[model samples]
Target chain A: MTTQPNLAMRNWNQRVGRTALYLVLILACVAYLVPLVVMVMTSLKTAGEVQPGTIFMWPENPSFDAWIKAWSQACIGLDCRGIRVGFWNSVMIWVPSLILSILAGAILGFALSRWQTRHAGLILGLVLFGAFIPLQVVIYPLIKMAANLGLYNSFAGIVVVHIIFGLPVLTLIFSNFYVGIPVELINAARVDGAGFFRIFFGILLPMSRNILIVALVLQGTGIWNDYIVGVSFGTPDIYPMTVKLQTLVGSQFGEKEYNVNMAATLLTSLPPLLLYLVSGRYFVRGITSGAVKG
Target chain B: MATIEIRNLTKQFGAVQVLKGIDLAIDDRDFTVLLGPSGCGKSTLLNIIAGLEHQTAGQIMVDGTDISPLPPDKRRLAMVFQSYALYPTMTVRKNIDFGLRVAGLPRAEIKERVRVTAELLQITDLLDRTPARLSGGQRQRVAIGRALARRASVYLFDEPLSNLDAKLRNDMRIEIRQLHEDLGATAVYVTHDQVEAMTLATRIALMNAGRIEQYAEPQDIYDRPETLFAASFIGSPKMNLIPGTIRLADGVPVFDTGSDRISLAHYPFRLAPEDGMPATLGVRPEDVAPDAQGIVARHRLNEPHGADTLAWFTYGETNLSARLEPVAARALGAQATLGFNLHKLSLFDPKTERRL
Candidate 1:
């Protein structure tokens, strides 16, 4: 139906346009990846090789000495050791806090969706308002209350603090996920002899796989990297890795063991970085889907 | 099988009363259809009965037990939603087995019932697949299979066929009728379709503006509707309503349409001409056939609707539709005079719009 040369030129134009867009995207992705690559390569280098002058090259010799130093033998304050000082504490905090916050968000989401009881909208509004309050404003009152309750600087206190901070975002995510489910599904479940909890646990929970996985991965990243709550409520013996990393990098500045600092910084971000590598796309999808009603 | 008695059930949504004191008693194993147009409280009533919604004030008795306070799970009722809410993540086997499993039935019995329901609903091959992979009809079958597996005392269908294409809708309607006949289950179905209500219901509860206008068998509702709303709402192509004055002529009520005066039969209009009240005349389009010996009328328009044609003509300011034979309909609008059978005319008082 068309001339051969004209059709060929049109196809060539389309190919050029597509290739241009793909090239832009590829460049952007490379730009984002470069920082992580530098952190890893610098973590492998010796202190002399990691000097600012050699910003973009591989070291002539890579060694495990810096990694070992970052793990256990470096001086941080009076305690001469690595950021590994609170590794178990970080795991302990990250696990229980993540579990409790996610479960709380999901339970509240299901209750609000199903029962729709009196003052339910008001209650949900209060929760949303709680989320908008600045953490600084609540921290003083929370500390006072924690001290009054004999829980200041305790593991339970920190765990409870993480939960309180995590509620708004986690509730927002689960509520938005539950809202996306069709109301007809719940009505059908009701008519099929399922009560509220039964419908949530049996039907709604199973259908919410993509979003739940996204929630766990997100909460894992948030609590694992949290430094504010760790420093605020944790005892010296129970400090999380993030706080330990902060102190280690702070005091070991002059005579700057650049290798050890870079290694600790690299390790500080490894869990979340690896997590992002695996579940990154789904995480973004769920977060955006939760925000956008459609 | 069980009987359902709804005594003075009412519902209000944000100051707008939906179902205003509805009283109904569905006979045991009867297929009762709540028929209405959109915005009517038919669906609200169905939901109230299904325990998916709570009535503001009322009593609902099933099998002589008051179930007003019972949660949906304790009501022993199953409903097929209009959207056919099949679990998209589960296979047909899991979906149909859900209720049985919840009841703590043994695994073997659950499997056997799931197989039986799947086969009966003609979805045996689809038991391995999720609802997303099935066609519209297959999904509907799975929905019915899920309801069937429950074996509840009452089955509620909320416009379950409204989602299908016209052909599939009719096929499923026939299938539903046959299914009801085979099971003899006490089913309460809701639909806005006249033909579906007519063909499928043992009795119909015609609702309008949140009130039950009439409740009777399909033919009775067609033959003698209680109100002007029911009379006009129940039939296809609709009944023509002509307004005019009426007077008693030799002990028979005759309508005076200014141009022509016609004698009425079999209507109870005791109001004298001294009242001088306005009146409405009603007649079905199909009843206005052109017979050899009949009343004289003028033809105004002809509409060919395939299978049959509609003849529209005005005697005065009132327009009337009549069903004419295909040949006779074609002869219409060719500048010819036609005839009407006054024997089939339906007259109503224009002021109150009640049957005369």
Candidate 2:
């Protein structure tokens, strides 16, 4: 009929609209990628070539010397060692802190969401409210508490500080996710002779893979990029990579080496970047799915 | 199997009372169904028995053991949920064996039990597939298999077939009845459907507004309902109730409808009606017939069901229905005479609404 021609005309108009939309999206992607491209190119340039005017230009003689110097020979405070000096210390602090904090958050979340304890609503509200308070407001009190416990400027002190800050957001994420699961599943498990820990570990935990990955990537990035906590709580020799990198770049009364600073910054960001690259699919899916109730 | 007794069980949510002093007893291997409409506290009572919810004030005795203080995991029971709450991430095999695995049974024994349950449910091919891959019926079968693998003494079902389609629901109904017969487990099921209560329950506890109206066999409930609510709630087209006064004519009790008088000498009453007392007469549709020597009435409508035809007519100011043969129903015109089977009629006291 004559309606077929009208349908064809509408289809043509839709095609034009789609093309224009894709063109705009491509432009936006390029705008976001420019700063990352500049960082990589600046890291490759030699020390003398990294002048203020040529920051975004391609390196004239691209070499690995700046990377080698940033990794090994750059001076930071009294230590002449590069950002590599704090690499193992960061790993030590990050691994234990990540594991302990995630476990505590998950258990607390499961208990708060599933159990019928008195004042559970109050407890969850307090935790969510604690997430909004800035860390700088409580840093002095936290330092005083750590000193009273005789754990100030130590590895344990830094690990505890990371856990205290991470608990609020991690617990909020996990509790919100667990609240969406069906109550019948928990009842069925209880009727199957599963106790509290058994139901948590055997049934609920296995089905929480997506949310677990989301929590891991979030906590990994947050702990990896942390600088204030490390500088305040860590001794000179036990500084995490972020603290060491900051001191390396912000050295006063010394020649500023822009290439080494750029290289070290890139190196410090690689772990979290790799984490996102490897598990980006689950991150987006987890966040969107966890937002809505099943 | 175990005998279960619930003594004066009551539950309250804030100020609203959901279950008000319920008492029930299930014999060994009895399929007792708690039947009621939604918000009637049938499912709430079932949850209390399964230890999922604690009763506000009551004692639940399982084989002479009071389980009031115990957690749900300590109670040796299994439940089939309406949602078929199989673990989504696990395969059917793992789902069936999850209880056994948590109970610390040996691996070989757990595997054998799961195999036997799968074969019994005819889901062997689906053992490796996750719950997401199975259809609704298949997931329900896996849930039942999970409960069966536990071998618990008491099994609770909370409207398990409500999620299935109509055809699948009927098929699963028969399947569940057969499963109960084969296993001979003491089962307590909950449903709001009267047909399900009639077909599947050995004893049906009819509940309304957080109270049990009647607890009897299905035939007893249909033929001799104890209360007015039970009488109206159990039938398909509903029992017709006509209000009148009981008076004496020549020393014989008669129902006077102010338009016509009917003799009640052949009607069996639990207590004889006094003269000059208000009464209501109840008759099923099947008990009325079209006859030559009967009350003359004008036909209003004819509803042709598959098995029979229901003809509606006015008697006095009350409309009444009669179940007639399809062929006979087709022959009816605008006017017909209706006969009531007087011996099968029920008489109720208007004040108490109880059988007289």
Candidate 3:
């Protein structure tokens, strides 16, 4: 048995360690939240109030003028209309890109993991290799190919680029998920006369809700935040919010409007941020689902 | 009903050979069991028959049609897995009719087949529940109902009852046997439990190390084991194999274990053995009894098994086990005389391990 004084000393050490851990955690949280707090306070300030030495101060007379200007009246190049055009473009690009990529990824993943085909290993190796290649390396060739198909500087071109880039990683995620399912279940389906498409639609698809949610959150965020692909493949008429936001912030000639820029930045990021907050629980669960045997 | 013929079925994984040329034939409506320990290729053989695994070099004929090239669904075979691989997302009713639906049967026909199968398996009430909501036994019944609804020509069971508790296993074993008899269906079951093999199989193929040692009726395999391995593998307390020598006394053969001699005058010899030949005597624990006119042995231990008792004895240096009645077990003594039932004695050649 431990002595009374020794046990008390050990308990004191544990208390000190726990307090130190909490102190570190609170400091880290404050450090991360500072920038976000500054953004909100700065966006609330009017043009005159948003000046130097007022970074952490509250807005003296808060108004929605900056927000309204960012939404409908800000200028990018020659257009006086604000980022609303880019917001609609981003939505149009993201929806088709998300759906087509997820459908293709899920089917390819199911086939690669379950079916015994002649070139399955080679196909899987190629897909894995494709996932590691940087998007910048293939951007020029994809542009040339899109131009040949009469799709460059168009809305379809951006959606197609996102789908192509999204396929490799999404397939890998879905393939890993499918591999966690027991092989006996697959065999039973085969014995039950369920062919390739039937097995996917009937059995495996219904059980893939968690992994599909994961794919949606990941791909939605990536495609929405993409600026290079959007600006490179799209014309000014079809530029997504990221590209339009860059033009709105960096193209000003005089008297830079910090509040308007901050408001536009916040507006550009709100959709994906809301998406993550809404399904954050499912996102964590999906990532950790197959890690442990249930 | 279908007859399965497996000719020279062999399987190899890289350099390791799992099955070395197995050949067997099953008659229509016969319940044939492949009984062996783990890694003995019994499950591999069942998979080969079920078309789940391809044999290295073999031919499998079902009802005289070579089905080696067909897929599992085309082979007219249904399998019940050990894990009861029920589709977890669907209701039990959908699980039973999945195969029928896949085969493109009409709606009314699929419903009727599902109803008949559920009634036969007595799982009618469980049809609406999903597999996740059912108990272990109920899940097993649904699995069986799934296969029964398909009404395939042959049913393959891969250690179906091994997952149940003791009492449940016994109950399921009887129910499976009764189902086989009622439907007159051919079944090829694989199991390691000898009691399951003994109680359920019409014929037991005793296997060891990727080869069948003996294939015969259960009682024949138990009473007249053709090899030493078969003799030791089939008994509960295990057959006591006492090494001895056959000595000719006045031209009549007698087995001499160091401490005692037993006359083999009434022993049916497949072939007459030479004098002074080394042999091993195999006698089951149940065949040895306590008697006054017999060889004496020191009583070492008594194990009470509810209805009967097993007494261990030492004769010279060789240990023996005798199954005794409750009354005989009550008469405790330091030493006792034991008699070997001569009709049940098995003589094996020591070198070849084969019966002599």
Q: Over the stretch A234-253, how does candidate 3's per-residue lDDT look in tens digits? A: 98999999999999999759
Candidate 3: Cα lDDT at A254 = 76
Summarize candidate 2's per-residue lDDT along A184-281 as a digit string, tens digits.
99999898889888888888899888898899999999999998898887788889999888888888856788888889888888999999999999
* True lDDT of residue B184, candidate 1: 84
Better of 1 and 3 by TM-score: 3
- What's model 1's lDDT at B206? 95
After TM-score superposition, what is the CA distance of residue A75 in candidate 1 from its true location, in Å?
Answer: 4.3
Question: What docking grade does candidate 3 earn?
Answer: medium
Sequence-dependent TM-score of model 3: 0.91
Q: In model 3, which regions exceed 4 Å deviation?
A: A1-16, A44-57, A60-65, A79-81, A112-114, A117-125, A149-151, A154-157, B247-253
Clashing pairs in 1: B267-B356, B279-B350, B280-B349, B280-B350
How far is B10's C-alpha from truth in model 3 (Å)? 0.7
The prediction achieving the highest lDDT against the true structure is 3
lDDT string for model 1 (A181-269, tens) is 88888887777777777788889888777688788887889889998888887777889988988888887356878778788888788
Q: What's the DockQ for every one of the candidates?
A: 0.66, 0.80, 0.61
- The better candidate by DockQ, 2 or 3, is 2
What DockQ class does candidate 1 belong to? Answer: medium
